[model samples]
Target: MIKVVAAVIRRGQKILICRRPEGKNLAGYWEFAGGKVEEGESKRQALVRECREELGITLSVGAEIFRAVHDYPQYSVDISFFDCTICEGQPVAKEHSRIEWVGADELKDYQFCPADGDLIEILSRGQSGI
Candidate 1:
């Protein structure tokens, strides 16, 4: 299984979400900001790195808010979702088609990867459980 990490970055009542760019595996799907965990790196480290690389922002990763194991036709993934704060720089869509700060209730309005379904429901109901 591929180990992945994602961030639930919140600003007041809003949460950050990114859209996968065209030509990507899940193009146009909205999802959290994060990526695969590299070998020898902790989940937090990978999350910070991914936020920087993909969103052009630095993150202070916090508690794990959710986790999911999902299988796509291409592969299976174990994804860890964490609460995060942006400590430096504004978010830029360096690798995504776009980025938006949406209220938790608005999450369900966007199309997302299947792996994010359960977490989206939890967050949309304002139940981070952190």
Candidate 2:
């Protein structure tokens, strides 16, 4: 399984979401910006690095909000989601096709990855039990 870390970055009433670049895996799907956890790195470390690399922002990692094990025909992912706060820089779609700060109610308009759809529902309902 591929271990990955994603940040659910919230600023007041908005949450950051990004669309995967075309030609990438799961292209065009909306997701919280993140990437694979490198060997010997902790989830938090990987998350911080990924946020910096993908979104051009630094993050203060918060609590683990969710975990999902998603299986695809080609591979599988063990994804860890965390609540996060921006520490420096603004979000830029360095790795994504687009980025948006969307309100919880507007989340349904975007097509998210299956695992991320579950997380978005949890967030939209103001329940982060996972």
Candidate 3:
């Protein structure tokens, strides 16, 4: 399984999320900011790198808030969602089509990536501080 890291970056009452750019496999699907874990790198390391690469910002990665394994038609993934805060730079849509800070209750309004299904459910259940 390919390992991945997603940042649950919270600001006040909203959380950061991004939209996949067109031409990507899951174009337009919203997801938490993160990317694949590179070989020989810890999930935390990948999360930091991905935030820079994908969001053009630096992050202070925090505790892992959630973890799940899911199989897509193309491949399976083991994903860890971490609580994070921005340490530098504002998040920009460098690799994504757009970015937004969405409230927990508004999460269901967007069409999210399949890999994010579990996390979405957890947020919807009001199990998280959100």
Using TM-score as the measure, which candidate wins?
Answer: 1
Model 2, which residues run further than 4 Å from truth?
A: 128-130
Q: TM-scores of the models, in the given order?
A: 0.97, 0.95, 0.95
Q: Provide the clash count, candidate 1.
A: 0
Q: For model 3, how does the per-residue alpha-carbon lDDT over 10-123 read when each residue is reduced to its tens digit?
A: 888789999999999889999999989989999999999999999889999999999989898999999999999999999999999999998888898999999898889888
Write model 2 residue lDDT over 63-111, tens digit each, in one string.
9988999998899999999999999999999999999999988898999
Per-candidate local distance difference test: 0.94, 0.91, 0.91
Itemize residue pairs with steric clashes in candidate 2: none
Residue 51 of model 3: what lDDT?
94
Decoy 3 TM-score against native: 0.95
Worst 10 residues of 3 by lDDT: 121-130
lDDT of 3 at 14: 86
lDDT of 1 by residue, 4-85 (tens): 9999998888999999999999999999999999999999999999999998889988899889999999999999999999
Ranking by lDDT: 1, 3, 2
How many backbone collisions does model 3 have? Answer: 0
Candidate topping lDDT: 1
